[model samples]
Target: MGTTARETDRERHDEVPVLEAFTRFLGLQRGLSPHTVRAYVTDVGQLLEHLGGDEDADPLARLDLTTLRAWLADQRRRGMSRATLARRTAAVRTFCTWAHRSGHLAQDVGARLRSPRPNRHLPTVLAVDDAAQLLAVAQDRAGDDDPVHLRDWAALELLYATGVRISELVGVDVPDLDAGERTVRVTGKGDKDRVVPFGVPARRALEAWLERGRPALAGPASARALFLGARGGRVDPRTIRGVVHRLTAVAGVPDLAPHGLRHSAATHLLAGGSDLRTVQEVLGHSSLATTQRYTHVTPERLLAAYTQAHPRA
Candidate 1:
């Protein structure tokens, strides 16, 4: 064989500028969510950190199956979950692919990187009557017609009624609501927008809050975020979660979250005989498969309902 070859350290450190540029490119060109961008940045940063201060070798030329596998092993030793590892692997692969395409690297070093499979845990949901009772308890807390009380009831009601995610709920603007039609347009992940209708209870609560509460909370400097915080600022997702937990606890549901209400809504809709496609559209799921997971059914319950209702049975 010919003489053994190796890359210099300086060449490796030279790719730092390219990596940083690629990160900026992702933000500008991909229009990815801030959360996604942060995840990508963290993953790439971890790899760079692992490489230490070595900069003489071409980073791409030095990278190979061994270093990639070693990095994964190191992460695993540190007790990172398979899901996190998988995400990091994906980030590295994407970075490598972009680097190769942009001519920053001679070869795609991460071409063979394989992410470990992640667990698929089913989401938790609340029963219909239990959810109703919870909502009723939340409604009871309005202290003889207070706007904040009204707002809390309305928030929970809309979440359960529409099956919209908490991010979508908090992001709602005043113009998105159409009280006459009892419908609101929600922006879901990937900025996909969908119109969801609310029932009489949700409608009433929303109207009361808008008329009585929002005016009290709206500040001239504040942007048009639908839910206002205690300080008259745009409500953050964390605050929405805290509100859900606090209200749900009073309703005898200590485990409920905003997403749990969404799950409850989908399951209840399916049990109430709403077709999957209709539920899919209402939930604004980009794919039917994602929505189908909430089509919950207990085999015994299905059998009993069939036996009780079917003339043939």
Candidate 2:
């Protein structure tokens, strides 16, 4: 009739192992990236901590819609952004589904959970002429003698040319590039690899860096890294961002992040008549819907181009 000491000990012992098991399942079974798996574990860990990790109350047995909503509300009250709440909501939903499939729960309580949609903000991008002028200036600064300048030029060209994320850009190595074909093999999210091509300008910049620039900067730690920092180590994303910001300011445009170049590349591609699916593959977007955002940036440019060129008016 009464609660026993052995039952309480057993309940306490169950909580940690289940969470650890779920983590292993995420990495080994689901093939989730380390970053994504860590996020899921953190999201669920916070909820479990919120539920007080009761020794007598199992998380799977006690979890339900009400408690889930209460946790979300608490996070909101603590000033978590709607976007974060939405992400956490998705994470929990995924965890619940996984738990159900693993037989930890009799039902999927998160099937009906909901969170506020994050506002869709259009990405900042440069106009076509601004992008050209910025690169031109970078090219001028990249005069043959300076390895840093050469590296900067190649980085800027490759970024705008291929639209790879800063992380992917930094991760590139000498072996990744195909010189004659002018393509680079990039490993994107979930460790998926794809070959992306660049045009003549990017190829030339890369050649200059690889031939003249990289050799000058190469040190013990360089190890075939495509980009290098001041100390001859692999370049970091922050250094890349600083380069973009400084270049844009000199180009007489608003200081922009490296990602703004990516946005510019996507927008320019669409304005130049690239189809959506083609753009999607070039951007390495997993969803066609995610790639559709660039379509919004193209209509005004299209109308402007049409108005100037068409005789129908």
Find the candidate with the highest lDDT and give its number: 2
Query: TM-score winner among the candidates?
Result: 1
The local lDDT score (0 to 100) that residue 309 gets in candidate 2 is 87
Identify the runs in model 2 with alpha carbons over 4 angstroms from their true place.
Answer: 1-20, 53-56, 300-313
| lDDT by residue (tens digit), candidate 2, 120-190 | 76667888889988999889899855998999999999999998888889999889999799999888887
TM-score of 2: 0.83
Candidate 2 clash total? 0
Clashing pairs in 1: 8-56, 8-57, 9-55, 9-56, 9-57, 10-55, 10-56, 12-57, 12-58, 12-59
| Model 1's TM-score against the true structure | 0.83
User: Clashes per prediction?
Assistant: 10, 0
lDDT of 2 at 159: 95
Any runs in candidate 1 off by more than 4 Å, and if so which?
A: 1-20, 58-61, 300-313
lDDT (Cα atoms) of all candidates against the true structure: 0.79, 0.86
